[model samples]
Target chain A: MFEKYFVFSPYFWLVLFFFIPLAIIFKISISVSEWGMPPYQDIFLFDNGFKINTTFENYVYIFSDYYYIGSFVNSLILALISTFFCLLIGFPLAFYIATSNIRLRNILLVLVVIPFWSSFLLRVYAWKIILQNNGILNVILLNLGITSEPLQLLYNQYAVIMGIVYTYLPLMILPLYGYLNKFDLNLIEASKDLGLNRFKTFFKVILPLSVPGIVAGSLLVFIPVVGEFIIPEMLGGSDRLYYGKILWEEFFVNRNWPGASALAFSGIIILVLPIVIFQILYSRWSQKNEI
Target chain B: MKSSLIKSTVIFLGLFFLYFPILVLIFYSFNENKRVMVWKGFSLRWYNELFNNEQIIEAFIISIKIAALSATFATILGVMIGYSLVRIRKIPFKSFYIFLSSTPLVLPELILGLSMLLFFISLNNVIGFPSSRGQLTIFISHVTFCIAFVAIIIQARLTDFNKNIEEAAMDLGYNYTKVLYKITLPIILPSIIAGWLLAFTISLDDLVVASFTTGPGANTLPIVVFSKVRLGLSPEVNALSAILMFALIIIGLFYFYFNKKFKH
Candidate 1:
């Protein structure tokens, strides 16, 4: 079908289909600064001439509204807490795997990666079963006489954190593994040779040198968690709200295209700022160390 | 000695944390109870129901079709872009190409889904080709994201590749296209296969992009399972999860076996 259209009016097809879309996207971005009103509102009136005025009302509304503000805070807090948990659990495993001469290191690495190969939604579902009120964990606890009643584990903050950490741990490990795998043993040897204890040597040498990997891994986990919807929606109960869920509700449930676009655009800006700063700092630190 | 034991135990516990949920999922697939929590002894009833469900079977077919077609398209486009970046010199904005290709890996799926949604809506209004969103639009979206991964992997492979063989082939009076097909391609076949499998798995696993782009009569398995879980969990959902796990495990075992056999 496309081939027939292309053959019929070659230049027309090329210009209209490809170049025109590119031009429109470029124009939309450029017009944002000049219009003095939000570009997202312009998208609503796309069929009418494509001119837009920038406004701060949408952003103001997001901040002033209780639901939106609460969700935004919830998203940030959840991401931070999850990143900390991942680092706590992941760091030790990565350190052991990196430093060991164990023959099964490769095997263990493959084991760690297998769960990642499973579908994300399936893995989350697996957690739902494990954390449910009458789920396996509660059953085991009750059977062991540790508790007489089943615990409320599913559809809560605890479950969401567990799900996030489970899904993102592999991501944390791979980068740290890369850095630690390539780490020079001689530095540790030199520290120990100077009578520094193992903990001191580790803190003074390994941890400091691996800052780049830590930053990279943290950014990788943090960015996605901020916009996470699936884990929260499935694991988090009715009361829990996050920025991603807000955007989903606006687009699909509320059918508020303008509101959704504004939220999404604002989200991109908020998420990117810290990452941009971190990248800049990381580069500068690396350059100074090189010098 | 105590610290070493603690370290080893920590490692073991971490492994348990990772595998425990999946094991529970597998175990529950055999449970005879309607409630996923209570173990009412072992049976194959859920798997039996799985086989009988027509809607799930159709969804499975749709999922496979999307995966296969999108993977093929992604591989072709990836190889083209990868080859261009590796073999061509003096291309303008090469760094830009690198950034564009890698962006999908880092960008939020919601953002990608929304952008593509907007892009398609406009395309339909303007071009009138994809008159209504459905299988084709969804396939295109999957391919769009999948190409980035394929291109990155193939490009990494190309960087390590020795160029002398290609130069020698061309020296024997073979044209550029001939050298590419006759020599370059054969050498990079393994990477291409790896890239294709990666793309295939990603397309199969996607929910966010598929949810945004998929129209009526084209629900993928992940989307179906998601909506079902939202309403309530069922033994059938467990059965479906088990089936997915079984399929992945088979593929994984085959991969390792082939890898070992080839190594020998």
Candidate 2:
């Protein structure tokens, strides 16, 4: 009976709050829109004598537009670049930390993740201060005689990528470190004994073993970065637009509720649902193997 | 020795990259000038101003209230979900249960926030209970998303937990509720606290979801802070950042402490 309670309570809450909300997004996406208080027509119109009032116009509109498609592509490219940078920086750091002595490993791991625990908006804002015209970076560059004048760094695609890479680096490193820490260090020596050079050993032995970590870390960084709003909003310029910004403007600025809902629902279908299903199946498969 | 030097340099550079902006933010928080980049003599003017700013103070209070409440609620529901997943064998639609609980972890906050805002609006249209979105709506959204995080933590902890202790308690004549209260809950208490802290931090730091779900008078610290720093920098926000970063790092330490203590 108590088991029933444990099972049912969360089941009920998740269904009501989580599942229902997602269902509503789909519902609103299919509904017709107009200028009004709630900004969309009722899907079920009772007063109109059992009329099923719905339209795929929103979906059609979004798919037909270059604006929507381009922004999505831009977001994907942005996410891909940021994820790559995160891996580039995070892999070495994670490798070293995982290979270190246990005591130092713990301290170093904590240090890597400490900034992650700090406020994200502030971290992005920190980039703003650094990339300013007369900021420390320019000051240092001038002192080093690298540039004759302060280069315009703030509010561009590069800054956005830098911010994303910086903020999301720990997410990449944590999982990589998790996998690498569990990795047997003797494998490297064995590979060396087998006459494999460092590069060959890494590619053949280390890299193959850490693929799971790479996938996990990449997913963690890629998925969120795709829809990241704050970094771009704080640091990006008009040089590029992203799906997140487009969605924000659709709902809040343009007042196109159905269009925004369509975009969001499409994101769910395209980006999230497959991954969620994959994760579920993956966990189940792993558990079965564990037994 | 050469490889070790390369490794040390990589690690040093990595840590330096990670921390440089943070240290800069802190360094500038003390700047006496109103212009954040321009360094005058060091002063605490912004810190003093931050305390007196009623909007920020109010938003901070609201954020704390929502985060605390959501953390508590999410913890309870999350523990139940975690326990159910790990221990119970008869959950209806177990895959669906897992999907519901875990999807929020991966779902972008933008989509999640849109769904929630639309959900609340639809709910109000149908039920007329929550006539307007405010603390209640934000609380609900926070708890909804936060449950996944807490559930993940608790699930991992309970999965690693030895079942023999609970089985032993059951065999020794303790009832199900008694065994759980006396044994399982106590053993998993650290994880629960850690879950709560993690949930709290996620909630407090969240800007996107809060922006979507927030109504009048429900502005959170992140919302207010985002507004101030969105277009440009604020010296007062710099000071706030310094203080908030310090406080949150302490919380992070506590989280690490609780989690580490649980490993034994």
Best by DockQ: 2
Off by over 4 Å in 1: A1-56, A63-66, A272-291, B1-4, B168-175, B252-264
Worst 10 residues of 1 chain B by lDDT: B255-264
Could you report the DockQ of all the candidates, in the order they appear?
Answer: 0.40, 0.90
Candidate 1, B-chain TM: 0.91
lDDT of each: 0.76, 0.94
The lDDT, on a scale of 0 to 1, for candidate 1 is: 0.76
- Candidate 2 lDDT by residue in tens digits, B152-205: 999999999999999999999999999889999999999999999999999999
DockQ of 2: 0.90
TM-score of each: 0.86, 0.99
Predicted structure 2, TM vs. truth: 0.99
